[model samples]
Target: MEEFFKKYKIELEKEELEKFEKFLEIFKQKNSQINLSAIRDDNGIIEKHFVDSVMLNIFLDFLEIENPKVADLGTGGGFPLIPLAIVNPEVNFVGIDSVGKKLKAIDEFVEELELKNVKTLNGRAEEIGQNL
Candidate 1:
């Protein structure tokens, strides 16, 4: 897993790699039971979900804010939200999804990953946007 990230020129610590490993395990275990996503293969998840998600850090790394807060709309299976939160522990993340069951899986990911900088919200873009 670390090799994959390194191939993409994404640097990560040993602890962060461990979290990503556990996160993948949890995702696979839960996804089989709940059918949380259509992309199942390891490379698919890695290239599409994990690496692709963490790659967003390139943009965030330039942010000048003291504490950055990011939102991932339609965050099915936690996608970029989980990956980013793991890599960027200083940045706060809120993953919003309309599917309540999916959000439950994200909650599990958050707890299992022991991530302190992440949160999940159950709502749609328009509905949530109207309120905020």
Candidate 2:
């Protein structure tokens, strides 16, 4: 992944990389117990889930807002938001999923990752939007 990130000119700090590595381990372990994602392989997870999520950094970097907020609709297994939150600690992320079990897993991941900027909502977009 170091070479992969370097190839793409993605700048990830050592600590961030370490956190991602830890996240990978945790993700794989949990995935085996319960189907986390259709893309199960490590390379697939890294590319599709982790890197794909981090790619949003390019847009987030352009945000002029002081406290940027993002919502990942139908977030299955916490994908972009989890990786995004890990990298962008200053930005707040909301992951909305209809599945309570998936959200529970996300909560566990957030606690294990010691993340302060990530929150999960277990509801469909329509229901959540109506409330807001």
Candidate 3:
């Protein structure tokens, strides 16, 4: 994890690190009620969700997009969207999920993290993308 942060120092933020941890906790609690994610284990969440999500910063940097608008298609439980939003507060992030329960979890997570540039929509990306 330290290596991951060191590799992408410019995009990572201290506040985002804190929010990522909080997001993990919230996912754990919400998992009991709804099947938001298939990976219910802590290690899985940390690796597949948290780490993978944060890694998007590297992609953004590679693209040389200073303030790109990102859409996380089928962003179940806010994977690769919430963490990316936290790390790159300057960028806009929109999470799309058809599951109401999952969207609810994402809304709660976004509110808890006090994110301003992140939005959650309860629908499929295929349907939304056509309108865009």
Candidate 4:
């Protein structure tokens, strides 16, 4: 778990980390309610979803982002966005999704975890990205 902590240490507070633990539990419970996640089991969620999402940090420095305004287009199930927010609080993050159910799920997750630096928008990326 040290590696996990090291990876996410910049963003997650002790309380947020604790909340993440609880969020996982709640996600598991609520996931059944909404089918928000494909990875049903805990190991799958941890390995495939969580770890995989956290790994995006490897690209930021390589991509030479001092600070960037990132948009996670079509961020269904909050994949790279949620975990990315947990790993790099300094980076400005926005998650855009067209699915209302998915956005609701993400809103609950964001609220429960109290992730301050992340925001979600319900719209098509093409429509909004053009405006930006």
Best by lDDT: 1
Residue-level lDDT of model 4, residues 28-50, one tens digit each, is 88789988788998767766777
Tell me the lDDT of model 4 at 47: 61
Clashes of each: 0, 0, 0, 0
Q: Per-residue lDDT tens digits of candidate 2, residues 8-57? A: 67889998888888888888988887887987887788888888888888
What lDDT does model 4 reach? 0.78
Q: Write the per-residue lDDT of candidate 1 for residues 78-109, one digit (tens) a residue.
A: 88899999998999999999999999999999
Highest-TM-score candidate: 1
Instruction: Give me candidate 1's TM-score against the actual structure.
Output: 0.94
lDDT (C-alpha) at residue 64 in model 2:
75
Q: Which stretches of candidate 2 lie over 4 Å from their true place?
A: none
Q: lDDT rank, highest first? A: 1, 2, 3, 4
Worst 10 residues of 1 by lDDT: 39-48
Return the clash pairs for model 4, or none: none
**Which tens-of-lDDT digit does each residue in 8-113 have in candidate 3?**
4534466766776788788888887788788998777877777777876667888887668998888887888887888788899899988888888888888988
Between candidates 1 and 2, the lDDT winner: 1
